[model samples]
Target: MITLISSDKRKFHVLEEVANQSLTIRDVIEDRRGRRRADRIILVTNINSKIPEKVIVYWLRHFLMPEEIAHASMSHKKAEKLKKWEAKFFDTDIDTLNDLILAADSLDIPSLFDGACEKVSDILKNRSAEEVGEISKIENEFTHEEEEEEIPSENAWVWRNEFA
Candidate 1:
């Protein structure tokens, strides 16, 4: 088993094949898995727990058996289940979603990047400006005078249950 050290110092045990799904891991494993004392320890020192957990779990599934997702001849029920699982995995809050996107890009996981980006976009779509700001936790930069001058009086209470 390969030892993976996530950015947050969390250690994980995974088969080399699974860990190899990460480009960074794959490069290290390719150089070491065949060596007499090939280092099995991979240190990822710029991420957090949630990202590594997500990566480790996804690679474990996709690396050794990508054919499952690529197989077009599978029974409909099995494919449907996989689809449902993927949908659920992609459904994340804005904070986790943003972190996952950054992690995916750093680790060179294209599918994960696109999947999370799509979800983030979905969350942003059809949202009011204030809702977007609130969802993303973005503080308004307007000063007191600026806020007073630019406040939309007509939609001042747009913060109500209009979207509820």
Candidate 2:
């Protein structure tokens, strides 16, 4: 078992495999130095006390118990199920995604950071300026002149083509 300490000093018990998804945790394990506990005491200063709590709790609940996850060599069916479960593990709302990005970035969890950033980028892409603002929860502060300036040309919107 591994202990993960939050910015607010909350501690969570998690499995090593699950917590090692964060590169920060991996480094702690890899370090020959005496600071091995550094991995267990993660200082996610940027994330609020909520997201890490949820993520850590989820890992504990889902993967901590030995009976919860069996090795893939034992059964193909179990392995497939585990794969599917992990695939949807990070699914969340936009605000939660942003929080994940903040937490992951602060923790130096590259995979989580990349995943959250890619999700945000995908959400912003293939969307008009108004749609992007709406998804980001930004009020449409652009004046009429700004709106006019946003559209490159009337034909661009009217035509179908992928620009990059």
Candidate 3:
């Protein structure tokens, strides 16, 4: 087993095989294969305790069905089930999703990264500009004049509505 220490000093003991889903952890384990047991402790300094817990949950879920997923031989029903499961798993607030994205990227877990990114995109899609900004907690810094006049004038083609 390898111990993953979160930034908040929480320790998660994970089987090497389950943790191997993370390329970074796999590489670290590979590099310290013959070392003492102390080497098995990996400090994930960039991610807090909550994220690691979520990541571990994600890893465990994927680990349970890696072969079925990788082989492309899973039954249609199973695929649909897994898709539904993923949708529910990723249905979280934007801040948590963003944190998951960063943790996944840092851990080199592409599947998790992709899933979290897709969730974030889904939350933003087809929304008005103000809605998107509000959901994402991004302040619109442009003043009234800049928004109504300067920006539209600068990007005239975008505001033309000719296609519509």
Candidate 4:
């Protein structure tokens, strides 16, 4: 088992295999291989307690798989079940989702990072720039003239009545 320490001093105990899903944690473990598990504590100072707690939950949910099962093609039923679980897992508020994305990126967990990115992309799809900005909590920095000229020119298809 590995003990992960969050920035706020929260401690999470997780299986070494599950924690190794994060390359950063894996590196730490490897570097401390000579030491006992009890002596090894990975301090994730970049992320706060809440974010690391969520990350630990995500890691546990996506725990270790056998090498053969990991590499081989999954059955449709299993695949669909995993898809549903992922959808539900990522069905969080935008702020939490953004935090998850950043945490995943920092931890070097590609699957989580990609999943979060896809979820954010789904929210952005078929939405106007204003809506995207609102959903992503980004202020529209473009001037009115820039919006008028660039939006229609670059996204003419989105401006069409049928598309809208």
Candidate 5:
């Protein structure tokens, strides 16, 4: 068993196999092999307690089906079920999704990172430039004149939704 300590000082106990879904955790476990039992405690300083809970749940779900089976010979119904579960899991507020992306990246969980990024893209899709900026909290740094004239004039072929 491995104990993951969250940034908020919460501890999550998980089987080593389940936690191995994270390459970072797997590597840590490998490196500490034959060491004292205390070495099994991993401090996830970058992720908050809530994120660890979510991550553990994700790990447990994925752990149920081995990767070889999931990638090669899983039944169609099982695949569909897993897809639906992933869609629902990622259907969350933008801030939480962003945090999950960060945590997944830091933990080297590629599937989680990609799923969260896809959801974020879906949320941003079909939105106007201003709406996208507002949703992403990006400030418009360009002056009104620069935005309306200079940039468009410099790149005349570039598509401008607002101007269209």
Candidate 6:
């Protein structure tokens, strides 16, 4: 078992395999393994307690199975179930989703990072640039002339139809 210390000093006890999903945590564990300490504690300084808590939840949900079982093809039923779970996992408020993305990236958990990115992409798809800017809290700095110059006459129809 490994004890993860959150930025606010919250402690989470998790299985080694589950924590290993985080490459950063795995490296810390590896470096400390030589000491032969019965209990291992790793401090996550980059994220706060709430973010780490959510990350731990994700890690537990995606706990790795045995190598053979993991490599074996999953049945359609299992695949669908996992898909549903992923959808639900990403069904969070925008702020939380952003925090999760940052946490996943910092922890080097590729799947979690990819999932968060895909969720953000799904939200952005089919939306106008203004809508995207609003959702992401970014101010549009392009002037009218710049916008007009950026869209060529040939593609103006396409752009108009897309944003219409």
State which candidate has the highest TM-score: 5
Name the best candidate (by lDDT).
5
lDDT (Cα, tens digit) per residue for candidate 1, span 57-144 = 7776566447545486767887777667768887777888888888778767877788889998899899887998989887899888
Query: What global local distance difference test value does model 4 have?
Result: 0.81
lDDT of 5: 0.91
Write candidate 3's Cα lDDT for 83-124 as tens digits: 898999999899899999988898899989999999898899
Candidate 6, residues 5-102, lDDT tens digits: the string is 88788888888888899898789788888666554877778567887788878887777433244347867676677779889989887778898888
TM-score of each: 0.72, 0.58, 0.88, 0.81, 0.90, 0.80
Worst ten in a row by lDDT for model 5 = 155-164
lDDT of 3 at 39: 84
In terms of TM-score, which candidate is stronger, 2 or 6? 6
- What lDDT, from 0 to 1, does candidate 3 have? 0.89
lDDT of 6 at 113: 93
Instruction: Sort every candidate by TM-score, greatest first.
Output: 5, 3, 4, 6, 1, 2
Off by over 4 Å in 4: 36-39, 64-71, 154-164
Model 1, which residues run further than 4 Å from truth? 36-38, 63-72, 139-164
Please list the residue runs of candidate 6 whose C-alpha ends up more than 4 Å from where it truly belongs after superposition. 36-39, 64-71, 151-164
**Per-structure clash totals for the candidates:** 0, 0, 0, 0, 0, 0
Kindly report which residue stretches of model 3 are placed more than 4 angstroms away from their true locations once superposed. Answer: 67-71, 143-145, 154-164
Q: lDDT tens digits, residues 136-162, model 5?
A: 997889999999999889987667557
What is candidate 2's lDDT per residue for 28-48, written digit by digit as tens? 766734555443555555456
Ranking by lDDT: 5, 3, 4, 6, 1, 2
Clashing pairs in 6: none
Tens-place lDDT per residue, model 4, 2-112, is 887887888988888888889888998888898876777777786678887878777876774432554487677876777788899899888888889888888899889
